[model samples]
Target chain A: MSELTYRDALNLALKEEMRRDPSVVVFGEDVALYEGSFKVTRGLLAEFGEERVKDTPISENTIVGVAVGAAMGGLRPVAELMTVNFALLAMDQIVNHMAKVRSMFGGQTHLPMVVRMPGGGGSQLGAQHSQSLESYFMHCPGLRIAYPATPADAKGLLKTAIRDPNPVIFLEHELLYNSKGEVPDDPEFLVPFGKANVVREGSDVTVVAYARMTVLALQAATELAKEGISCEVIDLRTLNPLDVETFVASVRKTGRAVVVEECWRTAGLGGDLAHRIHEACFDTLRAPVRRVAGLDVPMPYSREIEKLCIPRVETIAAAVRDVLAASV
Target chain B: METKLRAVLPDHELVKLYEQMVIGREFEEACAEQYTKGHITGFLHLYSGQEAVAVGATAGLHKDDYILSAYREHAQAIVRGAEPKRVMAELFGKATGLCKGKGGSMHLFAPELSFMGGYAIVGGQLPVACGLAFSAKYRQEDRITACFFGDGAVNQGTFHESLNWARLWELPVLFVCENNFYGIGTEVHRSSALPTVHKRTCGYDIPSEKVDGMDVVAVFKAVKYAAEKVRESGRPYFIEATTYRFRGHSMADPAKYRSAAEHEIWKSRDPIPAFARRLLDEGIAAEEELEAIRKRCTATVQDAVTFAEESPWPEDRQIWEDIYV
Candidate 1:
């Protein structure tokens, strides 16, 4: 195992995948020479040359549409939208074409491609730049969504997503890029989809989250452990092949749950997760499932107010305590 | 007369082109009849008057070249060797359809035949065509990608974006715009700032031209030359085929917006009869031969309709299938 930052791990994953498969090509706005807005594609153009590592025009919809076409024409294309906020611009291609191509074409074609977008709040990028739209993609069928929190999982899940025969929406958090962790050096190391990682083991309360929220949940779990309130932190690796079984089992054991999401409170993924937990562990639950979600408002530009919109470690801990205190 | 005919193609190939156009017209007419009877449902955009564009363009490109089009693509698919029966069956939503009843009339796909797909969204297929061309260029393959869209699609952002991308990347793609004058109900003059579609490619630095879409030989010659230029230069080319749809945009449209005189003028230039007249005048084929070709085409369309009627419905279990790999 080698210690690597989340960004480095992702860059390594792209390098490894491109080396492993010649058909794997990378392209997006500033992805080639500029190395991507997030630098996840750093050193790709130097290694793969201009033909494979291309910098496309600033056309978000066409970026994804071209990826879909490349995948259909037998090339594995990993396209990047500058950020999740810009993905809304490309929603037509993402939802209408990329997600619908395979099923609408009657299984005759499979799009082996990945669209990477760096998103999540707390950086004070304002309303348009800082938004969590995972639920928007989750609402659509025929797409696999992967949002990894740690370096290891980031590398593993992205490699797996690159090799998967279906179109994958790979979400990366902007703040987590500098965070470091141990990652497997093996090019073959892959984290299978639909399996939630049990980041922390406890029995009092189950904290379910993904991407940047998962990192905060782990921190909250550590802080909760010192307070004699053991919280089991579950990092949902992939949202689509949602490991409802793992979370359900955790809720059954803990008899309480707190779902944390960075997206809006209204119609957030938390609502769906909490509902599923309630349905599966209704008899076993000692308390109604609680949710710590992003404030239902456009993300504010002020750093002070921006911090209040998304879930912090303190907010996660408070939610866990709230769920624990509400025990029947 | 023989010299004029030979300038476009051999007599035998011209005859074959005529047969393909007749098949397209017959299949679309049949689809209209079936739609009226409620056999084929959903948005049915028939390629009735635009037969020459599809048939001629398909003939112009290599068999290995990738072809993608807008919703009015039944003729394009059939011209590219997709079985007419399978395409009709797809419209009928049968299990034996090209897309196994999943993709209806608007989304016919035959990857094996190199007919990529029929996109319902205006200008959606343009970027995809670039991708296919990108793939071909990446693999050092000799094939090119042929993308067909209507005049209405030119107003879409994808049209501009895809054109710029194709030229910037130097990808081998042939963008064919079937300028049928109207986008649904609004005519090109109303919808576009510049109604001249082919002239729009100049902004992207891609050379383009306009062709008389009603003449099969003219479309074939233009597309053939442009496709070869794309192949040899490894760059994009554009052709705006000036044409009109004989019918409404889809089955639901009554086309009350079009004037009788305008419709009559376009109908007078009906490609099938015009080409048949040329063949007769050039002594390429006798009237009896043309009649035989029409009979054969009618039989082929009838066979397609019968196949669609006889085919089974997709099983209930298939709904859960094909969503993922």
Candidate 2:
């Protein structure tokens, strides 16, 4: 094992997949000679050549749609959207075409494709650039949504997503791309989808989250540990399949749960998780399933306002503290 | 990749094209009758006069080449080797249909034959076609994807986006635009900033051509050359086949947009009989051979209708299956 940043781990995964499968092609604007918008695809063009690693026009719909068609034609295409914000332009292709092609086409065609987009807020990038759309993809069927919370999860889950025989929406946190952690050096290390990692295990309360929010949830768990609050931090690796069993079991033991999501509060993925928890473990709960999400407004540009808009470690700690105060 | 076409597609090929056009025309008319009898119920866009485009271009490609089209695709499906009974059963929402009755009319998919689908949303199939072409190039397969859409679809963002992407990536996609001069009630001039649809593909740097769609031999020649270039270079090409719909866009349309004189002029350009006349005038097929081809087409369509009528409905539980693996 060696320490690698989230971006490096993702890059390594792409390299490994390309070497492993010749059919795996990567394309995006500025993805080729310029490395990448964030250097995630650095050295790829030099290593793989233009045929496998391509720079596409700045058309989001075409980027996504081409990926879909290429996948249908029998290539494993990994398309990179500049950010999740730009993906809105391709929503018709992504939602109506990618998400429904399998089901609507009567299960004959498998969209074995992957769309990677960086989402979430922290750099004061404002509303247009910083947005979390994992919830939107999770709401759609025929697509697997992966939200890796750590570098290891990033590498392992991305490899799995690329190899899976279905269309997958992989959400990466823009803020965590430079964050470093130990990732396995093994080439065959692939994390299966829908399995949540028990980052911190406790019996008092369950804190379930994914992607960037999971890091905050763990930070909150650490701070709460000082006050004798034992919160089990569950990092949901895959957002769509959703490891409902892991969280449900955690909630059953703790009799309480708090769902954290970086997206807005109303109609967010957290709401769906909360509802699932309430329905599954209603009798086991000592308190209502609490949700900590981003503010229900466009992300603000000011650093301070942006900090307030997205959930923070302190907000999560407060929510956990408030839930524990109910004496579960 | 022969652009001039070999021997102008023997008289038999023209006769076969005439038969297909008649079958497509008769099949669409039957769909209207079935809709009245409550056998088919979704939005049905009939392609009564645009037969030459599908029959001509599809006749130009190899069976292994991939195909995708917009909502008005019953004719394209037939030309691309989809059994009419299965397609009709799919339209009828029966279990034995190509999509097991799930796709209705808009979302027809036949993967084994590489007939991907009939997308309902305007310009929806462009990216999927690009992806398919990309895959063929990635796999080093000598295949191209033929994607079809209407003149109204040219104004859509997917049209421009797909063209740029296919050219930028140099994918083997042959975009076939069936410019019927109308999108529902809106005319080509009304919907597009530039009414010349093939010229619109220039922004993407894709090489495009225009042909008289009423002439099946001309369409066949153009598509064959375009498919060859796409396969040879693993790049994209565009062609706009100028044609018209003889009937209304759908069964409910009264077609209040054009005058009767315009309708009569276009009806005179009806591809089926015109191509048939050319074949006879050129000593390609005798009148009796042409009548035999028409009779065969009518009988084949009748057999398809019987097959659709006998097909059963899909089970209720089937709807819950196949959404995922």
Candidate 3:
């Protein structure tokens, strides 16, 4: 095992995959000469040369569309969009083409490609930039969505995403880029999709989350442990083929659940998770399923207001306490 | 001015080109007939007036070369060797269709034949075509991607982005614009500042030209030359083929935008008969032989209609499948 930041883990995954497979290529705006705006693609251009690692014009739609074509033409292309907020510009390609091509073309082709974007609302990047649009991707039918919360998962899940025979929307948290954790040194280590991790084991209240919210949920669990409340935290690494069994099983065991998502509350992933939990463990539930989600307003520019918009550790813990308190 | 034509290609191949154009025109006429009879449904865009561009362009490219186009691409795929029966079956939403009825008229795909697809969204296929060419270049394969779009697609941002990327990477791609004058109801002059489609590629430093789309020989010569240049230089080239669509944009529109005088002028230069006249004048094929070719094309399209009528509907379970790998 080696200590690595989430950013470095992603970089290592790209380098290892490029070295292992000659068909693997990376491209995006500023990804080659700029070594990535977040430096996750650092040293890739130097290692793979310009043919494989490319710097493209600022065309988000075409960037993703080209990756779709490249994937159809038998090359594994990993495209970056600088950030997930920019992906809205490419929604036509992302939703209409990338996600629909396989099925639309009658399975004559499969897109073995990954579109990586860093998102989440901690850096105060403002209303347009600070959005977390993971739900938008998860809602799409023909895509696999993966958002890793740790360095190990960042490397493992990214490798899996790169190798999968379908298009993957690999979302990274901008705030988690600098967070360091232990990553397995094995080049072949791959985190499978649809497998939720039990980050913390408890029996009182199950906290289901992923990406940055997973970190906050774990923190809430730790603080709740001091107050004699055991909160089980479930990190859903992959959202599409979501491991509802793990969270449902956790909720069944705990008899209460609180789902947290960094995105807005209305029609967010939290609602989806809560519905699944309610459906699976309705008979065993001692309290109603609660959700700790971001406010339903557009993310603000001010740091103070932005902090309020997203779910915090305190917000998550308080939700857990609410569910636990209502149980008795 | 009547440009005197020389026998640039062999007699047999020239006759074959004439035969393919006849087949395309026959197939499109059948599609229109089928649409009227309610056999083929939903957004049927006929390629009647634009047959030569598809036939000539397809004939000029290698079989291995990739061809991608916009929705009016039944001719493009048929010319590149997609069977008319299966294409008709797709329009009928049958299980034996090109996309197994999942992709109807607007999205026909046969990847094995290197017909990437026919995208419905305007200019959506440009960047994807660039990627296909990029892959060929990266693998050091000597194949060029021929991307066909209508004049309407030039207004899209993807047109500019794809042109710049294709030229920037120096990928081998031939961007063919079928300038049918009107984008549905709106004419090109009202929408575009320059009004000339080929000149738009100048910003990317990609060499381009304009060809008379109604003339099969002109389109063939231009695309053949452009494809060769792209193959040799490993760069993208643009060609704007000035053509007109005889039918409306889709099956819905009546195409009231063009005047009766203008319509008469384009119809007088209809590619299939014009090319046939040239062929007969050049003593390439006898009148009896040309009649035999027309009969054969009609028979081919008739068989396709019969096949589509007999094909079964897709099973209910199939709807759930193909959404993933």
Task: List model 2 lDDT by residue over B1-325, tens digit each.
Answer: 4223237775556667777888888888888888889888979889988898999899888898998998888988887778999999999999898889989888888888889899988988887888888788778888889999988788788888888878877888999999989899999888777898898777888899999888788888899999999888888999999998987888789898988999999999888888777777767778898888778777887788789999999999997988777
| CA lDDT of every candidate | 0.94, 0.88, 0.93
Ranking by TM-score: 1, 3, 2
* TM-scores, all models, native as reference: 0.99, 0.96, 0.98
lDDT of 3 by residue, B1-325 (tens): 5554554788888888888889888988899899999998889998889988998898789999999999998988888889999999999999999999999888999988999999999999999999999999999887999999999999999999999999998999999999999999999999999999898888999999999999998999999999999999999999999999998998899998889899999999999899989888878889999999999999999999999999999999999999887
User: Candidate 1 vs. truth: CA RMSD?
Assistant: 1.1
| Each candidate: RMSD | 1.1, 2.3, 1.2
Better of 1 and 2 by DockQ: 1
Pairwise TM-score winner, candidates 1 and 2: 1
Model 3 lDDT at residue A56: 93
lDDT of 3 by residue, A47-155 (tens): 8999899999999999999999999899999999999999999999999999999898888889999999999997878889889899999899999999999999999
Tens-place lDDT per residue, model 1, A1-328, is 9999999999999999999999999999999999988899999999999988999898999999999999998999999999999999898899999999999899999999999999988888999989999999999999999999999999999999999999999999999999999999999999999999999999999999999999999999989888999999999999999999999999999999999999999999999999999999999999999999999999999988899899999999998988878899
Candidate 1 docking quality: incorrect, acceptable, medium or high? high
Q: For candidate 2 chain A, which ten residues in a row score worst on lDDT?
A: A319-328
How would the docking of model 3 be graded? high
TM-score of chain B of each: 0.98, 0.96, 0.98
